[model samples]
Target: MKVQNKIVVVTGGGSGLGRELVLALLSSGASVAAMDINAAGLEETVALAGMNRGNLATYALNITDRAAVEALPEQVIARFGAVDGIINNAGVIQPFVRLKDLDYAAIDRVMNVNLFGTLYMTKAFLPHLLARPEAHITNISSMGGFLPVPGQTIYGASKAAVKLLTEGLSSELLGTNVRVTVVLPGAMGTNIAVNSGVMDTLEVKGGEAPVKMLAPDKAARIIIDGIENNRFRVLVGADARLMDAVYRLNPQRAARFIYDQMKALLPQ
Candidate 1:
């Protein structure tokens, strides 16, 4: 669906790709409701939006709260008149450790933010989206969702659940006014580690070749283009595209490749 004049809600819009999406949507003439748990981050996003600030509204929300999530459509409608689309982009990563060393609390937190949060937002806004003449839902999964990463087992699992959930939603919503799209993005230059509270514990190995990271603005553009064209799956970055093909051709090899790359971060 075309974004012009549409009212779109984006989770985790305080920073990273989410913030970029908000700015991009506003520039495309869409009214946006940018939701995030960090109020300061939201402020920063708005400040960066410049003149497009008029087309944007910021909401400080914890998507894990079902009650709060369920109430979003009403609030968004009150602010922007109607809800046409929602992008579930808020997610956190697990600590850089093997699953055996990972704590249940950490696992639960990742599941709550990544899987359950996406589900809650989709369920809450789906009805409103269906009511619109043209509406869309975009869920952000990760390259790790399709290819296994040794140190991020729980994070990968949560994203994989999102991948399937989004696909199922797309199938179920067939012939409806609402369109569902899932995004698989590769490594991007974002503060996700900081936002997810994993930066301090995340270990990086030196002497490893640096991988080119996708910029948030570029990623946002690709995602918005996918939404406009109503694509079922959107892959951002060259790494994501390459991995998608690799996984398709050889799932085992893809898994092993990712494991090899990430195993260095795991505790010896």
Candidate 2:
């Protein structure tokens, strides 16, 4: 579905990729309802919208809160008159530790934010999307969703669940007007670690090579293109693309390769 005249709702719109998606959608002539947990960050996103600000609405929301998520479509429809699509872009990563050493609190937080958050947003807006002549749902998974990273196993698990959930949703919605897409993004230059409160624990050794990350703006563009074309899956960044092929060819080798690249960031 084309987004040019549609009203799209984007979660995690406070900062990072979510903020970029809001700006990009506005530039593409789409009205947007941008949602985030940080009111200050949402304000910043609005300021960044400038002249396009009038075409956008900001909502400070926690997607993991089912009651709040369930009520969001009404508020967005009130602002934009109708809701055509939703992007479930909000998520959190676990601390860079092996699962055996990870706490249940951290595990639960990751699952709640990544898996349950996406589920709630999808369920809440699905009915509205179904009512529209054309509608869409986009979920952001990660490269870790399909490939293993030693320290980020649980985070990967959450994303892997999202990957399947999105695919399943697409299959179920097949013959319906609502379309679904799953995005698998590689490393992106965003403050997810600081936001997730796991930055302090994701330390690298003194002489290690700095990992390359894709710009969030570029990642947002790829995702928007996917929504416009109604693609079934979108992969962001060359790293994500290459890994998808490598993992498809040999899952064992891909696992080992990622472990080597990430082992330095793990605790000694």
Q: TM-score for every candidate vs. truth?
A: 0.97, 0.98
RMSD of 2: 1.0
| Full-model lDDT, candidate 2 | 0.93
lDDT of each: 0.93, 0.93
Tens digits of per-residue lDDT, candidate 1, 1-268, equal: 9999999999999999999999999999999999999999999999999999998999998999999999989999998889999999999999988889999999999999999999999999998888899899999999989888788989999999999999999999998998889999999999998998887666667845346789999999999999999999999999999989999999999888877776766789
Clashing pairs in 2: none
Off by over 4 Å in 1: 207-210
Query: For this target, which candidate reaches the highest lDDT against the unseen true structure?
Result: 2
lDDT of 1 at 155: 97
Model 1 scores a TM of 0.97
